[model samples]
Target: MDEAGLIERTKNPATRESLRRDLEGMGIGAGDVVLVHCSLRSLGWVSGGPVAVIQALLDAVGIAGTIAMPAHSAGLTDPANWGQPPVPPAWIEIIRSSMPAYEPATTPTSNMGAVAEIFRTWPKARRSAHPATSMTAWGRQEDEITARHDLGDPLGPTSPSGALYRSNAKILLIGVGFNRCTALHLAEHIRWPDRPSVREGAPILVDGERQWVEFEVPQIMDDDEFLPVGDAALASGVAISGNVALAPCIIAGMPQLVDFAVDHWRAAKHPATPR
Candidate 1:
């Protein structure tokens, strides 16, 4: 919606303080680690836009807490998989050879939205090393959460998803639905350990030098595929729903959510098996 429409719907602008209150009401509290996915527009007109939204999250989490967001650089992926605006087959090799290496300090997030893009550059934020599926985090546990990101298992046990799961973090969805949840990808990995594999390449720093590297990773599924599992979570009360400003929101424990998705998908895959 346009700014004018957002302003009209918002009634009162969402300032950092107000947003923090809403977040706390939704169960975000001090010392809690959270993986957030948000759309600034979905919150209606904010007093400080994405900045305010992020600050409020920080305020709710406090100094003892941590906040993390997907800083995925999908553009760094193999050009051969480019479908939104596919490049000519002949140009793929040229693009691969010339593409700039993924630099966590400068690489911009693709389609992750304004809030995440801002969080990626937030002061003291630590980003994972994965060239494509890196996650950025801030606050107390930032280092521990972003320390290791396995190239072959970008969302699996060695990635930030695993760290967050181990930490029992919360997944906060603002102005977005289950389809935007990245934590669910971890469930996919668990449910289909032998899922199909695909070759992916990207320019990344190796021994402090830029080089094009290739690796085999489990084929990533479309985000929409998580919708059914997410819906099921809400239906089963695994996730709590509320609102921040005019935007709909959901908060759930990351481990619970992932475990639920694994079971949900398993049941779907094996209809006769009791959940």
Candidate 2:
């Protein structure tokens, strides 16, 4: 929104203090590990933009808590399978050969959003090394949460998202909804342990050299398909809604949301299938 319109709705510029207060009011407090999926535009003019929003999250969680966000880097993916905007057939090999190795500290995130894109670059932030589905984290368990990420199980139990669930993290969706929620992927992993796989490749440093490695990963479906599950979750009152600096926010426990989604998906996919 324009500056005047944003100020009108927010009553003032969004400041670190204001954002912090809003987050606390929305039930985020000290010692709460949170996985955030946010849209900077939906946040309605944060005073310092994504920077202030990140700070507010840190402040809300305090010194004892941790915060995490998806730091996926699509550019690191195998170029041979680029369908959305596939490259020329002849350029596939060139792109694959020239792509840089995924570096936890230097590689840029694909398109996680302005907030996450910036948060991943925080000086002290730690990131997993999954190349395709890496996650960046801060605070208490930053290392523990993003320590180990296997390419084959990008969203499974060993992935950062899974670690968050095991840690009983809270999911905070800012100006977004279930479509942007990463926690639900954990449900997919649990719900379909033997789900079909897709070929994926990325450049990684192995033996001190950039090698294009390929593997098969559970084919994580589109987010649009998750709408029904999220709608049901909202109807069941699992997702609590509140405001944060003129933006709508959804908060729910990571495990609860994942469990709720898995049950809903199981029932929907197989009506007569026993739980």
List clashing residue pairs in candidate 2.
none
Taken over the whole model, the C-alpha lDDT of each candidate is 0.90, 0.86
Query: lDDT (0-100) at residue 142 of candidate 1?
Result: 96
- For candidate 1, what is the total of clashing residue pairs? 0
lDDT of model 1, residue 89? 100
TM-score of model 2 vs. true structure = 0.94
What is the C-alpha lDDT profile of model 2 across 126-244, one tens digit per residue?
A: 99999988999999999999989998989899899889999999999988988888888888888878778888999899988999999988877687677778888888988888888
Q: With candidate 2 superimposed using the best TM-score fit, by how many Å does residue 156's alpha carbon deviate from the native?
A: 1.0
Of candidate 1, the 10-residue stretch with the lowest lDDT total is: 266-275
Point out where model 2 deviates above 4 Å. 1-10, 269-275
- TM-score of each model, paired residue for residue: 0.96, 0.94
